[model samples]
Target: MKEKNQWSSKFGFIMASAGAAVGLGAIWKFPYITGMSGGGAFFILFIIFTLLIGLPLLISEYIIGRGAGAEAISAYKKLAPKTLWVWIGRFGVLGCFLLLSFYSVVGGWVVIYTGLSVSGNLLHASADYADIFDKVTGSAGITILGLLLFSLINVIVIALGVRNGIEKANKYMMPLLFLFFIILVIRSVTLSGAMEGLKFFLAPDFSKITRESLLYALGQSFFALAVGFSCLVTYSSYLKKDVSLPFSAGWVVSMNIFVSLLSGLAIFPVVFAYGYQPTEGPGLLFMVLPAAFSQIPLGGVFLSLFLLLFLFATLTSSFSLYEIIVAAFTANRFRSRKIVAWITGLIVFAAAIPAALSSSLLRDFKIFRKSVFDATDYLVSNLMLPIGCLLIAVFIIHKMDKALVREEFFLGGTAKASLFSLWRFLMTWIVPLTIVIVFLSMLGILK
Candidate 1:
């Protein structure tokens, strides 16, 4: 049998895991959703869900991965041998495959936009920002090229193996991500009229909470943490036994939430300062951010930096998505990691092409009134993720041996017995029930 690859240090694992968690969801989606869902109230709800649901499930995946000390699918097979539970990991890989297909599409957007910003194409624009965005997304060739490049990047990094490739890249990228966001926040909050946006972002309005918003907050918590789908399971499989799973999970959760807060601080203040509406949905990052940057000094420079940061976040997350698949295929043959990574990257690139062109060539392609891109995203985020979370919660609580669970929790003496009891309760009861309720609400079965 071949030896398994492990992270060189606890820090490397944490950064890589946190890199997976902190992606475009934190930088782009969280702020916009918070704005649309009533700002501080939604933010508070998201944090609650993150703590109660996201954190527990995150630790659950960690336990499964490090406990099994194998790939995502094999983790389940190892834990619940001779059962159908391995399907959970298989579904996770499938979900991740579908996820990265469209995920890379948006990652491609960041890549293309970064190039535009660097080339001065985005500067001195007299046309509407929305029009610029439309032109960019409407160009099939550019979008496809960007998607291919993004996938190639993922392939190259993942091919290098975990400690040397994924971990090394994240160590630099994650810290730089934080630094860049801090700069943007300072610039944004200092802008004239920025206070209104900050107020709108930080002030809670409980009356604005709706069933739909509640569901969104739940989904966003899962999305933001990169929980569910066993992606974390793959990442954690590389962890050393001496490392504390609970501590690692806590940091990943904290870093993700902090980045989300930083993203809101960086974006909303600038949005208000620039007099743009905050409810611009997904376009807030692509459309509104460029316009806001245009008004600031060294706007082009800052825009380029922001795009680079965005690209890093996207690539880091893409690495995990691709890693999950690659890890599965290369489990028994470690030397084949490079070949598997290339093959996986090519497949994901091919799969994502339609989504890349969904705004143009595939514009009319619709499933339930959503374009191919939107439908793919909807299926993954709304349906697949919640279901994955539910299954993981149930499996961890019901299938795993109680002694094993206690051993995992008490391994490093980090978590107390009472805390383990609370975590188990949440995993067994609160987490599964909340996910089911959110899923049913998404299907309109409740209302």
Candidate 2:
């Protein structure tokens, strides 16, 4: 048997894990959702649920992975040999596959826009942001090209192996992600009318709170940290025994929240300052952002920087999604990791073609009254993710032994009985129940 790989340093582990957690969920989706879901109130609700739900599940995944010292699927077989708990890992890998399909479609849009920004074509004083966005999404050639290129990037990185590949890529990219974020925030907040955007994003308005806002806020927090899927579990599997799970989890969560807040500060100020609405989905990032940036001095240059920032965040997240799927098959493999990775990339690129054409050639096709891209997003976000999370919570609380959980959790430090109890309480009761309610609401059974 071959020795399992370990992270070169604790910082590399933190960055890779944080890179996994911070992607479209934080920068792209969170800002638009915040705009639609009561702004500051929704932001507050999201933070509350992140602590309650996201953080615990993150810790549980680490405990499961490091405790068992195996990849995602085998981790289950190692711990709960005779039972069907292994299905959870299978489900998570499947979820990631479906996620990356549509996720790559959007990633392609970022690629197209980033290149356009470089040519000074996408953002200019006379450019129409809405038309540019529409053309990009509606053009099959452009969308497919973007998706293919993005998929190739993911494939090459995964082929290079863990330490020399995922870790090294994130170690530089994650810091650049933050640096670009800070620069954008500084530029955005300095614009006239920026204070109004700040107020909308930071000042909680109880009056604007709605049932939908609460639901989205909770769901956003749960999904935003990249916990429902088994990607983090695979990443943590590479960690050394001496690394502190709690401390590492803290850094990932903190990075997630901080990046989310920074995205809001970066985008909302620009949206408000430019007198534009904070629209939802690709429109916000592609349309509204371009329009806002176009109004700034040398906006083309700043827009390129922001797009590059967006590309880095998207790639970092895609790396984890690709890693989990490759790890699933390549564990104990005779075939090369490179071969498995290229095969995985081809599968994703093929699956994502319809999603990339959702706004164009496939515009007439609908699943559950939604476009392919929208339907895929809804399925993963609303159905697959919540179910995956619920199973994880149940497995941790019901199947795993308490002593083992405690030992894995506090392995490098003294056990805090209070923290253990709190985690147990949430996993045993709050986490599962909350997921059930949210799932019910998504199905229109609760409201």
Candidate 3:
């Protein structure tokens, strides 16, 4: 038997999931990637897929969790027979764990950057910021300290429980995040030569919209919206029965997509204004962003504030990831919630070791000549996410009662009914096929 939890309120659920969706992926990665992919064109494709493909999948996870009123593993078991569907739930949880393994390492970078920003170190090093980033990225000590700090923050939040835990943190953090983001975007757009970056970011060149670009857009949409993760399913288990899953999930995905687009607008103009290449990987934020900030008056202050906002975004998302694992333990027979939180945090800390040490001792322990971080990210993003989402689609459409799904999610009259068919078509055809092609492309088989 599982213990049931009711959400504190409607807004609580939205903020919590939105907090999950609005992570480092949005504030930094989205802008960097959009600029790299030819700006406005990629941004437009990303928005299109987010609504078409991401929204439906978001609703599916919410329905699964709310309708079943169970954790991800139990939800699937109750919703599907004992054949292979059970493994879907397991894989979903595994994906969450795998994600946190590297995500925490990145989360640590945010923490480090936040401290550096506050201390005025970021300003001094903007000239050759790549060298500074390389030093941090290469060090095992800094990474471990960062991972530990991230683990501590997430553990504290999860231990706080639902209303006080996830909801309260999001309610406060989300507003500050948006406020700072707006400020950063404004400051970034005002920089000299910023319009050139905005041109690349906002003015779409349709010629660049190749199949690969479209696929990348779709994948990023899903990941950025936090659609494929079982965290939504786990979080939704606490929802009140009367709540409209589709309406709520739509709002969450919408907000996240908006943030991603806004972030691209905020970042590209700055990147272009400064003549920075966007293909700088994880160092994009650390390296290029500093350069852009240096050219502004009181750039360090603004940059510090911006990175702090980025840190808050990453922390909120990391908190949700920890919540998913803790929910499983809390619902299952194990330690108490506090114990589960601590244990889960410790496990994540352990898993993050390889990625943290990737540039050091773990660099040589490579498969296919890639580091641990690369392997883990590739496996999760290319393989686990798509497979997990496919299982979710099958579970929702094939196994669960579509009529009940219609009643729960499609209750917004005729307009919603039309939307439901679009949702069905995308989940059934568009997303799955595109994921397959994207997976092949990532494996070098598409070329």
Candidate 4:
């Protein structure tokens, strides 16, 4: 029998898992959402929920993955054989497939912009940035080409397998990502009138705390950590039993939070210094940002670095999505990793075509009165995500043996029993209840 691959070191596992956790949410969504919400108040609530719900779920996945000593689907099967429970992992794989398809399209956008940044087109002072963005998204040829290019990168890296591929990529890229962010933040905070943006981001306004904001914070906690996809399960399966699941989860959570802070600092000050609206949402990253960067000294170079930084973040996240599906197929060793990876890449490229054309050739194509890209994002983000998280929480506390979970969680650490009890209390009650409410609210069923 072939031996299952393990991470070469605990640091490698932490970096890979954290890479899986940090994605576009950290780069694009986190900063914008914080701006729209109550800034520091929303951030604090997000941290609370992340620690309360997201952290426990992460630890649970780690325990499950390492405990079973198998891939995503096989772990469930090994733990609960011949039952419907295996569907949990299957659903995760399916969700990841759909996610990767569209995510790569976004990644392709970054790729095109990165090239433009390097070429100085994206920073042209007289250029209509909004019109340029529209043209980019509205061009079917450009979008699909980007999709193919981005997916190809993942295919090649993933084909190399974990230790040489995902682990190594994250270990190097994450530090570079932070360095880029720090340089941008320094430049941003130095801009005249940047203090207002800093105040808006770091100063908590208790008055901005509302029901909707609370829900946004909760959902961001899940989205920001990439918790719902079960990609962490595949990453954690590579972990050694001696590595502390709790410690790894803590670092992942902390790194994600720090990146979120850096993202806010990097963008909000620039937006405010330029008198641009922070609530520009998705356009803030693609449109307003480039224009803002254009006004700075040697802006083209800085913008190129930022775009490449974003591309790195996007690819890191995409690797996990690819791994979840690829791991399932290669777990039993019937298929070669390289072949399966290329096939997976091809499938994602094909699936992403419609989304790539969503704003262009397929602009008229709508599901549920939304464009294909918007519809897919809604399906995966609102529905599949919550259901996956709910199922994980339920599986750990209800379906799985209580004693084994207890034992697995405490395997490598001398943490307090009170901590385990707290994890149990949250997973058993608070986590599911919050997810259900947040899910319903997102679907407009509760509100």
Candidate 5:
């Protein structure tokens, strides 16, 4: 077996894991989905789920990782009772590949937008801003080019290994991401009528809350926390035993929420400022935000910086996703980790092209006749991620030894016996049951 690499420090592990959680899901997906769904009400529900449902699942993933000391797939064989749970672990690893495939494409968009921002292309754009969005998004070439560039960046980072590659990038890029985020929020929220957007985002609308809304809230929490993806498992496998799981979990959630809310403050104001409907779908960031940026003073500078920072967020995330596969292949001795890493990167690039060209190249592959993006997203986010999380919770809470999990996670000694019971109860019942229901609801199996 290839030698396992450990994080040089606790901070490195936390930052890397948090970087995975704080991906396009936070900066891009959260605001658009919140608006599209309803607004503050949906967001508040999302927050509730994050704290209650998301945190416990995260703890479970961490416990499995630290206890088993392996990648996601092999983690099952180490921790669970029956051989069956290993299948869940395998799906989690597969989900990583699927997630990375399209995520690389989106990451490329951020990189391209950053370059465009630096070139002042955004500043002088004409009044028909929506048309500009159409021009960029409708073109297949731009999308493919963006995916290729992002795939290249991920390959380079993963090849560099943890401390030298992941740690070094997070130490600099994550902080800069926050700085640019704050600056953009300040600028976006100050625009005339921006308060209208802020109200839309933060002021709760109770009417919007429903069973479906609750399920969506749960899904958002999972997506935002990156909880169900086994990324935490892969990442914490590198963590030293002395690190506190509860403490690290709290920091990851807190930092992710801070950044996500700040992203809302940044983007919602711009959406309202531009007179765009809050409910515009996936293209909200690329299409709506650019138009909003065009209207700001020094808009090009602000947007250029923001997009670059956004690229950092996505790059760090892509790095983690790639690591899941790299660890699996390398650990299994299929090839040197480095060779597998390169091959994985190339495969991701090739897979992403169809997604990039879904509206163009692979638009008509009829199975229910969905586009490539639709198919890939359904396979990963809606299916594998939730199932993987459910399995991890089951194995940790039921199949594994309780005393060991408690010892590893509640290392600070301040946690009482009752808290362990509560954690176990939540893991056994609340977390898994919720994920199951949400998974069913998402598939239209429940009314």
Candidate 6:
């Protein structure tokens, strides 16, 4: 039998896992969604959900992967053999495939924008940034090329294997992402009328909290953490046994939330400073941000850096998505990781073309009253993730041996026995019930 790959260090594992968790959802979607959902109130609810639900589920995946010490599909099989429980892992693989299909589309946009920013194409544009955004996304050549390039980047990194590729890249990218955000925030908050944006983002308005927004917050928490998709399972499978699961989970969650808050701080202040409405939908980051950056001294330089940071975040997440599929197919020795990564990257790129063209050639394409891109996003975010999370909670609580779970939790002998019971109760009860309610509510069945 071939030896399994493991993380070289606990820090490497945390960085790689945190890289998976902190993606476009945190840096791009979170700010705009917060702006639209009434800022501080939605932000507060998102944090609450992260703590009460997302954190436990995160630790759940860690336990599942590290305990089983296998790929996502094999992990479940190892834990509960000769049963349908492995389908949870299969569901995760499918979910991740569908996820990256659209996710890469946005990632491609970031790649294209990064290029445009570097070449001064986006500088001092007097026209509406919305128009510029449309032109870029509407071009099939640009979009497809960008998607291919972005996918290629993912393939190259993952092909190097986990420790040297994923871990090393994350160690640098995560800190760079933070440093860039700090610079943007400093520049943004000093602008005239910036305090209003700060107020909007930090001051909770309870009236903004509605059923839909609450549901949105719940979903966003899950999305932001990259839970329910078994990406974490694959990453954690590479972890060493000496690593504390709870401590690792705490770092990922805290870093994710901090980056989210930083994103809001960096974006909203600039949006208000430029007198643009915060609720500009999906194009807020690509469109409104360039316009805001155009107003500052040496804005072009900062804009380029920001786009690079954005692309870094997207690529890190894409690495995890591709890693899950590649790891499963490779199965440690079936095919080389490089060969599998190339094949998988090609498939994902080809699959994502429709989504990439959704703004142009496939503009008229519709499924279930949504465009191809929107439909895929909805299916993954609204349906697949919640169901996957629910099943994982059930399996961990009911299928696994209590003694094994206790051993994994208390490996370092730091956490108390009472805390293990609390975790089990949350997984068995709170996590499942919350996911089901949110899933039903999203389906309009709860009202």
Report the Cα RMSD per candidate. 2.0, 2.0, 2.8, 2.3, 2.3, 1.9
Please provide, for model 3 over 207-296, each residue's C-alpha lDDT reduced to its tens digit, 9 standing for 90 to 100: 877665765676677678776768788888877766677778777877897788677766777666667676566667777667766766
In model 2, the Cα lDDT at residue 285 comes to 65
CA lDDT of every candidate: 0.85, 0.84, 0.77, 0.83, 0.77, 0.85
Q: Write the per-residue lDDT of candidate 1 for residues 54-120, one digit (tens) a residue.
A: 9999999998887888889999999999999999999999999999989999898888999989998
TM accuracy, model 1: 0.94
Q: For candidate 4, lDDT tens digit of each residue in 1-447? A: 243546888888888877877878788778877877878888888888888988999998887887777878998998898999999999999999988777888899998999888887778888777679889999999998888889989999888865776677678888888887787788788888989988888888989887667767776787777777678877777777778888889999999989998888878887787767877655577875686677778888878887886788888888888988999998889899899999999999999999899989989988999988877876776578778889999998888878878887887778789989999999999999998887667567886
Question: For residues 1-447, what per-residue lDDT tens digits would candidate 5 score against the true structure?
Answer: 443447777788778878888988788878877887789999888887788788888888888888888888788777774679777667777788888777776787777777777887755666555565555555788878778888888887787676677676687788888887787787788889899999999999989776656665776787788877787788878778778887788888988888889978987888888788888766678776676677667778777877877888887787778888888777767677667878999998987887777765666664456677766765665566667777778778778787889788787436677867877888888888888787677668887
Q: Indicate the worst ten consecutive residues by lDDT in candidate 3.
A: 408-417
- Residue-wise C-alpha lDDT for candidate 6, range 1-447, written one tens digit per residue: 232546788888888888888999898889878888889999999999899888989998988888888889989889999999999999999999999999999999999999989998887758578788899889999999999999989898888765677678788878988897887788778888899999999999989887668777887888899999888888877777788898889999999999999888888887887777889867788876787678768989988987887788788888889888988888858688788899999999999999999989999989998989888987887678878888888888889877777778877438877878888888888888888787677668888
Q: Which ten residues in a row have the lowest lDDT in candidate 2?
A: 1-10
Ten consecutive residues with minimal summed lDDT in candidate 5? 127-136
lDDT of 3 at 15: 88
**How does residue 260 of candidate 6 score in lDDT?**
95
Q: Give the poorly placed runs of model 1, Cα more than 4 Å off.
A: 1-5, 125-127
Which stretches of model 5 miss by more than 4 angstroms? 1-5, 125-129, 210-212, 295-297, 363-370, 440-447
Candidate 2 regions exceeding 4 Å error are 1-3, 295-298, 441-447
Q: lDDT by residue for model 2 over 331-366, one digit each (tens)?
A: 788768899999999999999999999999999999
